[model samples]
Target chain A: MITPITETDLLLFYYQEADEVTTSIIREHLPENTDWQYFLNELATISSESSSLMCSPSNTTLSIILEESRSQLEHTL
Target chain B: MNAPIIADGVLIQRYMQGNQAAFETLLNRHRNRIFTSIYLLVNDRYLAEDIFQETFIKIINNIQAGKYNHEDKFLPWAMRIARNLSIDTIRSRKRMPVVVDSEGRDVFDCLGISVQSREDEQINQDEISALKHWIRELPEEQREVLILRNYAELSFKEIAVLTNTNINTCIGRMHYAILNLRKKMQKNTVRVK
Candidate 1:
């Protein structure tokens, strides 16, 4: 009997966290299943867009951190 | 030929040996993702900056004290620290009374709508601000999983371990978070048309 492919399984597969057998099953199953295929595409789009929204700390914060690191190095030396 | 990228482990070893440049390189490499993860959780840029600084200070102390054993897993380790600090600050803030401006409006209310500095930049910033608002609306658990997965870039297994939950629960939360965000975006698009 074939184990049912679940949304959770699709998520694992999308993130490349599935084991080899599950990965193979997802690979074979996705192309033949339109709903699953659409779901995968949605995951890809959402993941890509969300991950692209990168934010950086202010330069003042960066300077403080670097100074901290420098002081630590001096203490170690 | 391009220079081969130095690994995080090598950088850590060099930094431990008093190489400040190596540590800077390491910090710059993962800075944005780490900052974004903290900011998303806290929903305030200034507060996020404070937590980010605190996170790195602790990281430097830990490394110098020879307590940084995670080696190649620097981003996730740093992210875990940042996440913890953000959570603590948030909890404390919740206990305090809300701060409002002279106009009797919540000071934080204006923060969600980012200022558009240029005409060309407005649309992108608007979209990002909308997405941020939607993410903030999500349940805390789902939002945490999404941030750890996408912003922290932790694998499901790593997230499971960091969050102290089973892998299946993490994945399920992630699935729901994505679906909910997608639904929000689609609804927004339809409304805009």
Candidate 2:
């Protein structure tokens, strides 16, 4: 049986931000681990799906505030 | 009349120079991300909206009063205000914090994954589905870490700064989170078998 994948190794793989050497090692050894495929799929879904949720705030509210701020500034000036 | 928005620092400088249009432009650029983060924290739509408005109000009033500093990074500064206000609201209400990562998905604790039989695709899919369910059940801290790290694409450094914790602690939290999740999965698998 292959050695258990370290959390760090898996993390590097899942993030896919790891260096080439580490990634190559993970790629080379991944097939030996039955669970790696499931992990890979989950990572793919998570990286893609979760990213959309992480963007900064909406522009509508900001526009409203901006309009109001502009109006108030105009009136004052 | 459509054009790219200016940088946050440049916008702040213009606003400080009494340029309302510049300020408005900056607000438009950041509102969604700011509001979404606030909403995620409070978990109440109305409260989140209120806090979102209040945060901008603070920024505007501070700017007008010559109290808002442009040198400080705008995004984190705004987020700090929103986060503090949301945390205060949660505390005052004495409500246990509820994290909603998905629109309609079930919560599952993502501790450690189970030892799955790789030869069975059906079994693997079932295990994965079960894992998703468990991730939803994890505690707020663990769930947030998993979501922020795995989903938010935030660097460990960013998460550490945001959470006011060290990287090792964040990693440990993640480790425990996965361990707990894996244990739960193993138990469930055994039971189902």
Candidate 3:
């Protein structure tokens, strides 16, 4: 009997980090239609929200100051 | 910031030569990944920003001090700094319960996030929000591995090296985390039914 594909197995597959043996096993055990892919799809879909947090310091300001401050910080060397 | 595209090796060389624009280019490229990695863990915008800034500052200090050996990609090195700072903040706060201000309002909510992404605009809004929320609710060990893997895009091997654990342990933590999110989704579906 095929061992069940654990969520960790799916996670590794979703990240494309799973080995061939694990991938083949999961693929073998993958439910006919919507089971595994649904969770993985939902995960990949919302991964972008992590970046949605407000851009405090604003990207422009951060870009300028990060380098400008680095230039000045070089003076301390 | 208008600097041309250059490899990280080239950029580091330029920065070492005191060409600041190269530094800006490097920061611009990886800032979001680094910022998001830290923010997802901290769940506190202000603290995350502080960690982000400190991460960059530490990189610059190490670079200038002749210490930063770019054995791996520049982003991972910078991310390591961000992760350490964020975890340090968490450790310090672990002893004291999160306290509300005298007004009994969440003082943290004052520093709201600003640049939310529209990449997943096509997805179901409520489902995506719930999934994201559940991921945040995961235990720290599991959540850190997920954030490092998914958001930061670190390999299990890289995560093991960074977190100083065995690769199997990292994978195990990720397993439990995804399982936790899946169960939460199932529970939500059941409630709806």
Winner by lDDT: 1
Model 1 / residue A59 / CA error / Å: 1.6
What is the alpha-carbon interface RMSD for each candidate? 2.4, 6.3, 4.8
Model 2, position A72, has a per-residue lDDT of 56
TM-score per candidate: 0.86, 0.58, 0.72
Question: lDDT for every model?
Answer: 0.84, 0.63, 0.71
Candidate 2: regions farther than 4 A off: A1-5, A9-38, A51-64, A71-77, B1-6, B63-72, B95-137, B146-154, B174-193
lDDT per residue (tens digit) for residues B61-84 in model 1: 999999998544887788889988
TM-score of chain A of each: 0.90, 0.48, 0.54
Q: lDDT, candidate 3, residue B142?
A: 94
Please give, for residues A1-77, the per-residue lDDT of candidate 3 as tens digits: 76677667787787788889889887776667377878777566445544453234346447645765566656944
Predictions' DockQ, in order: 0.70, 0.23, 0.25
The C-alpha local distance difference test score for the whole of candidate 1 amounts to 0.84
What fraction of the native alpha-carbon contacts across the interface, defined at 8 angstroms, is recovered by model 1? 0.90
- Candidate 2 yields a Cα-based lDDT of 0.63
List the RMSD of every prediction in angstroms: 4.4, 11.9, 6.9
Instruction: List residue ranges in candidate 3 displaced over 4 A.
Output: A1-7, A21-39, A42-64, A67-77, B1-5, B95-128, B189-193
Give me the displacement of residue A71 in model 1, in angstroms: 1.3
